[model samples]
Target chain A: MKKKLYDLAHSRAGDKGNTLILSLIPYDEADYPLLCEKVTPDAVKHHLKEIVLGEIIRYEMPNLASLQFVCHQALLGGVTTSLSMDTHGKSLSYAFLQMEIEV
Target chain B: MIRIGSGAGFSGDRLEPAVILAEKGELDYLVLECLAERTIALAQQRKNRDPNSGYDPLLEKRIDLLLPILKEKKIRLITNMGAANPIGAAKKIMEMAKRKGIHIKVAAVTGDDVLEHLDGQQEVLETGKPLSKLSNLLSANAYIGADALLPALESDAEIIIAGRVADPSLFLAPMIYHYGWSVDDLDKIAQGTVVGHLLECAGQLTGGYFADPRKKEVPDLARLGFPFADVGPDGTAVIGKVEGTGGFINLATVKEQLLYEATDPTGYLTPDITADFTTVRLREIGSNQVEVSGGRGRPKPATLKVSLGYHTGYVGEGEISYAGPNAYSRAVLAGEIIQERLKDQFPDLRIDHIGVSSVHRTYFGELREPYEIRLRVAANATDSENAAIIGEEVEALYTNGPAGGGGARKYVREVIGIVSTLIPREKVQTQISIQEC
Candidate 1:
């Protein structure tokens, strides 16, 4: 069955300069491996291609059932210089959650 | 065991929660981590304008409100609210204490400001440009760590304030001072760092930012409680909030905050230690208590991160609202008109339909016709005059382009850009001064 990542996980986005640090944690620890296979750096890069304009790196934490994605050149120019209404990229977490994957 | 509670998370966090922590949480120390990346730079700019006023604007108010409770409860306070001007902040606190007839000891930690140490030959981590290339540099302050704060804690000053200390260090320093944990004890420092990271955001660990209506319900969110950690000698702690308070302190909230802004979990760097969060463990032992353990780390870095704030330019923005039938189209047309008018002069101008595609720069989910839409146009200009023109053009739309335009608003703001570089730890000297009232 296909399900939105939002259904399986929750996320939070944080910014550091021009980079975005996003954490994706599945509700069920059993689904950790599933997300590990499906939610690759390439997958997230493609999912948020319109907004994130740089390289994406994913680090897996199996114990916590979480995946940390570091998206570089992502915040337009970060909080200080970005002209976007959402200067902090606080809304990007939901945008990442909008991804659909096989459940 | 020592109980440490977080008072304020950022510069503008709610005040009552810290008061609650000081009063009812039976805390030994209440740490308020207030400074952010650009915060000190902004403070420095304020200091440049007025040498005596660069500390947190709310420092006096927060101290004024919490002083009596803290004094009565015997809970010491450690805060970076002294941002850009710890001495001024300390002096102000002493004056406030004197006026209230409350005897108090306040310590100010200084020397985080290293603006004179830079010769402009260093590299800016973000732009890959030499520091000399960046113009209108406002301030440069190193992110000092737990060690720099040790002398203030050792001085036994009831209120300790500083500028640009790393967020977690504000919480961890007390743990080190109380537990007698060696700075070289990487594992212990890491454990304390984990606790600090979890509790530093104050209400974050207590479900302040986690409520999601039907999805993730947080009870009595109207009066969310802050969190405290009961730290034992072995660097293990149980995180909880005041019972009967508004928010919950369970495993979920702890997990979210553990990685809040921790970019790389494995190598979360602080001046005291390189914390590794992957080894940490969390267990919800009670209704509103979680036991956390197994935090590990490596040696501290040789250099400290220095946040550099510089003048970027100015941001001009204008927003106008439209409603009723064809509001979306009208908003789109209004945006196009502004774009067309400014395209030649402001080539990089941006137009956003607020109800449609503003935040993410694109829209998702089912595309239902919005009953109302807001047209927003913004751009960056080298000068305030050029920036104001963008907003003026949008205001002109009220009479010239859109038919139902209302609630038109415009803004012009100077942009301060923050970047980072590294300075040797030895180059930065920390000093502690104490005042009593």
Candidate 2:
């Protein structure tokens, strides 16, 4: 079945400087390996290409069924200088959740 | 077990919830973590104008509300209320205690400010630009760690005010003081950091910010209770909130907050220790009780993160609304008209369709033909007067250009942005002074 990543997992967004960190945590423990395989740094970078300008780095934690992505240069100039309405990039998690995955 | 309650997560957090925690939490320490990176720069500017006014705006209200309870309960207080003026805030707290006829001692932790120390030759970590390039440097403070705040614990004061210490360090210093934990105890320090991280956001782990209607409905959010932790001797912690209060705690909320702003799970760096969150474990042992363990640690980072705030020009913004038959088209027309109008004066002006391209910069799926739309134009310029031109040009569209354009609002303000760089630990000094009422 084709499902939105939101249905398979839940995520949160936080930022430091010009970088945004998104944590992709699955709703079920059984989906850990699926995320580990499907949700690569490239996939996330492509998913959020519009706002993300720099490189993307992903780290995994199998025990917690979670993946954390550090998206570089995502915020225009970060919270201090960003002209965007959503300065902190808090809403980017929903954009990440809108990604599709086959289950 | 030592109980520590997170009173205020940020500088502007609710004061009533903190008062509730002080009264009923049975906590030995009430730690309020305020002072975001940019808050100090703003505070420093206020201090420049008036020597004693640069502290937290709600410092007086927070202390006033929790004073009686804190005194009666004998709960020690620790907070970074001293954004740019720890001594000023401490004096204010002392006056409050004295006016209330209570004998309480206040400790002020200082030495985080390094604006005078910078030789204007260092490189900024974010942009790699030399500090000399930035003409007006507003403020620069090192992220002091647990070691700087540990001395405040040794004082016989009931409340400790700090300036620019790391948020986690505020909660970790209490655990270190109580347990007499050795500086070499990486495992314990990491555990303490994890506990601090979890509780540092106050109600975040207690179902306040995690609620999502039917998906994750929380009970009685109207009176959401703040969070508290009971730390064991081994550095493990069990998180909970005040009994009979609102908000719920479970594995989900704990997990969400665990990775809140943390970049590296394996190596969450603080000045006291490099915390490893990968090995950390969480279990909902009971209602609103989650046992947290498995936080390991490595050596602390050699350099401390320095937040430097500088002048970043002025922001001029104008927002106008369009509605009825073809609101989206009218808003788009307004955007184009404004673009053409301001291209000569402000070449870099940005136009955003509020409901469409403003958020993610692209609207997904078929548009429902937005019944109402808002057109926003913004530009950064050398000064406020120049920035106001972007709004003036947009307001000119009220009768000159687009049809049905109304509700135009314009604003121009100064902008201050932050850049970070690391400084060696030895160059900075931290101090603690006590004042009794």
**Candidate that would win on DockQ:** 1
Chain B TM-score, candidates in order: 0.98, 0.98
lDDT of 2 by residue, B43-157 (tens): 9989999998899999998988988898899999999989999999999998888899989989999999998888878888876888888878999999999888888889868
Worst ten in a row by lDDT for model 2 chain B: B359-368
RMSD (Cα, Å) of candidate 2?
1.2
> Each candidate: fraction of true contacts kept?
0.66, 0.56
lDDT of 1 by residue, B96-203 (tens): 999999999999999999999999999998878899999999999999999888998999899999999999999899999998998888999999989988988899
- Scored by TM-score, the top model is 1
DockQ of predicted model 1: 0.78
Local error of candidate 1 at B117, Å? Answer: 0.3
Where in model 1 is the C-alpha error above 4 Å?
none
Candidate 2 C-alpha error for residue B208, in Å = 2.4
**In model 2, what lDDT does residue B135 have?**
79
